[model samples]
Target: MENKQKKIVLTGGGSAGHVTPNLALVPELLQHGIDVHYIGTDDGIEKTLVHDIPFHAISAGKMRRYASVKNITDIFKIFKGTKESKRILKGLKPDLVFAKGGFVSVPVVWAASKLKIPVILHESDYTPGLANRLCIKKAQKICLSFDTADARSERSILTGSPIRKDILDGDRAAGLASLSFSGDKPVLLIMGGSLGAQAINDAVDAALDTLTQRYDIVHLRGKGKLNPGLEGSDSYRQYEYMEDGLPDVFAAADIALSRSGANAIFEFLALKLPALLVPLPLSASRGDQILNAGYFEKRGYAHVLEQENLNALALVQALDALWEQKDEMVSVMGNSKEADGTSNVLNVIFENIGVQ
Candidate 1:
């Protein structure tokens, strides 16, 4: 066989969550001698995340849950994106398409199906997202993070969420040093998703005086969410985002306090790091995070604090409880079958593409 046996296109992104899993699969694809191409929206986060690859930009239409004037206009954009995707896929003639679901991926998958290119979709959430729901019939196989009895379908493969290889290489000391932390106290990592969770930020800020005494805080406050007033606190550090050093932070953290997005929580689980999860309420999202957190909680990997009951006091208390059970939680996570889905997802990809 030649060094490169097949070519494939990876599509997904509207948020960091969608792109990271696809990125996780890149190294293995390259190692297997398969060519990789990426298709994403011109300005979506995927373009930035997939910079090193051969990237194709297409228009993406975000379908919102609620009624909006923009939703009507987005229809035209979706058609344009679909057309652009078809043209790109035809020219590339990739053997397969591996899509991590997002608004951007729906068009790409549809285009792939129309062109008779096999498509595999990886769903990170327990339940399918809107984009995945739309493209399910078009996909040749659906990969699931949650492999429960109810989530099973004939076309579904039980692949846990793919975790980036870099995320597991974090050095605890390097992580502490990066944050200027003394390494004396437990490091608590807080992530509020990519868009920032105002409620989590406000609660953490309110509980800082108490929280800092026992833990060194490194807060990923999301874009433009940093509080200037908390700048000088010795035990606290805030960054808009961390990409290069995120693994180190993950390594340094003994316990994490975060919103239960599937990708973030799975990252924590993969590292065997115990977490206290605060899920987005139903009103905010489709309650996917709530289900993601509940799954972890049921498995003893994390603790869940619903948004409705979240506040400064509850945040501090829940974290304390998590700390008390950290060792047990870590033990459970160490043995969890769903810790990382990278390998399983790769197996399905290569199988579909007939590369291996």
Candidate 2:
């Protein structure tokens, strides 16, 4: 008798960080002949990023850490979303579900639990987010991107974050050509993530002349954050974002200055890119990025610059220090354990699905 085809339902959204891991799994799952599907909020980033895959959008409510006027209405939204998710799960009858941590994943995990569909949740932070904490009991396996994560459950497994394969194979020549850089100087890539960082942008922009004198700068300023005035500056290029060209840009970079988001930093580690990380301060975030940065610094993988103390002068000093130590940083990254979790994660999924 022939074996039945395996089907998987992946759920995560709100930010690109929550969705990219699922995207990393898609190509591998397809190669294994497994049918892949995504469940996300209708308006979330996941819906936009998970193109070419069969995506199912269901209503989801944000689980706020602070009190908000919408909390009352969001309670009803969660209940409604759970109902919708359950209905969708019943129709799809998938063999398993994989959830990356995000508010949009809560309803899908709950529905999968009630239906007895096995779930594997991936937590990318040192601490579990509110969404993942709620879904912990429902998940059959909890894959962690950070070993420091306090899942405490026997199901938790430390599997570093999954990274796209193409990112590791970027073409330096192509990257230089794409940016119209002469390759006369080292490239310093600045990325503030998909939403951009106003503080970093301001500081970098203010110190552009100083930075441009030392290196060619490729700045991903996030969506709508490009400065029109800097368009024709020598040894400087600014882009809102890059989809297909991101790999090439990475290849061309000698060093990086970035926000310390877990997924992004892990990709830097995997690619052996020496970076100076400026974590979002505790006032703005849950301090997860601070912890992530600290971890990398402790491991000698990257240098950290606190956002509160960062200015144009401080940014230049930090980048200069990082550049001076770039060789050591690259060596440390190379000596560390492999950072790509794609295969390890896929093995877990296959084990749970009874595939060898």
Candidate 3:
């Protein structure tokens, strides 16, 4: 008799950070003969990004840290989402549910717990996000990207962020050809997440001449943030974003300037890409990026530049210093034990699902 094919439901959204890790697992899961389904908010970024898989959309409510009138309405929305998610889970009857922390996952996690389905929650920061904090009690296992993260329950396991395997197979020649550049100088890649960083964007543009003189610049300037006037510069290239071509870009880059998001930084570490991290300030975030940057900086894998101190001159100076120490940074990253967590995370999934 043929064995039944195991199925898994992945739920997470709100931002790219919450979705990418789930995506990194899809191909691997499919290869292992596991059927994959994803649950996300109808209007969330996950809906757009998880097109390759079977996607179910449910209404999700944001759990804001601060009080507001929407809180009352959102409570109803949360209840509604939970009800919808429960129905979906009942019909799918998946063997396991894996959630990456995001507001959208809260409803799905609650539904899974109520139905007595095994669920694993992955947190990608030094501290648990509000969503994961609420879902911890219900999760059978919690996977953490940072070892220092507070695990309220003994079920938590420190598994570094999962990085997509394809990202590591980039071709340097193809990457340079994509930008129509000759390998005359070192390439510096600047990225500020998917939405782009306004401060970093402005500083990069302002310091273009200074930067271009020392390195070939490849900047992912965020959507709608490109300067049309700077289009034809020989040593600089600007892109809003690249999906399939990103790996090649990584292959082409010698160093990187980026925001210190856990998923992105971990990928950089896995790739051994020397970076100068500029974390979002406390005014903009909950200081997770600052903590992420500080951890890497202390480990000698990257350098940190506080967002508040960022400017054209400061950016230029930091890059220069980062370049000087690039070899050492790469060495530390190569030696780091927490580089990739794809296999560790997969082990958790298989263990919980009773798949040997």
TM-score of every prediction relative to native:
0.94, 0.95, 0.96
Q: What is the C-alpha RMSD of each candidate to the true structure, in Å?
A: 1.8, 1.6, 1.6
lDDT (Cα, tens digit) per residue for candidate 2, span 1-356: 99999999999998888999889999989988998999998788887799877989888887789889888788778788899999999998999999998988999999999999999999888778899999999998999877663544588887878888888889999999998999999999999988889889999999998999999999989898989999887799988888878899999999999999988998999889999999999999999999889989999989999988889899999999999999998999887653868887998899999877
Instruction: Extract clashing residue pairs from model 1.
Output: none
Best candidate (score: lDDT): 3
* lDDT string, candidate 3, 1-356, tens digits: 99999999999999989998999999989988899999999899999889678999898898787989888899899999999999999999999999998999999999999999999999988888999998999998999887673543489887889888999999999999998879899999999998899999999989999999999999998899888989888999998988878899999999999999998899998899999999999999999999889988998989999988999999999999999999988988887767878878998899888777
In each prediction, how many residue pairs overlap at the backbone (N, C-alpha, C within less than 3 A)? 0, 0, 0
Model 1 per-residue lDDT tens digits across residues 256-335: 98999999888998999999999999987898998889999999999999888988899989999999999999898898
Q: Which residue runs does candidate 2 get wrong by more than 4 Å?
A: 149-153
- lDDT of every predicted structure (CA atoms): 0.90, 0.90, 0.91
Q: What is the lDDT of residue 293 in candidate 3?
A: 92
Number of backbone clashes in candidate 2 = 0
Q: Candidate 1: TM-score?
A: 0.94
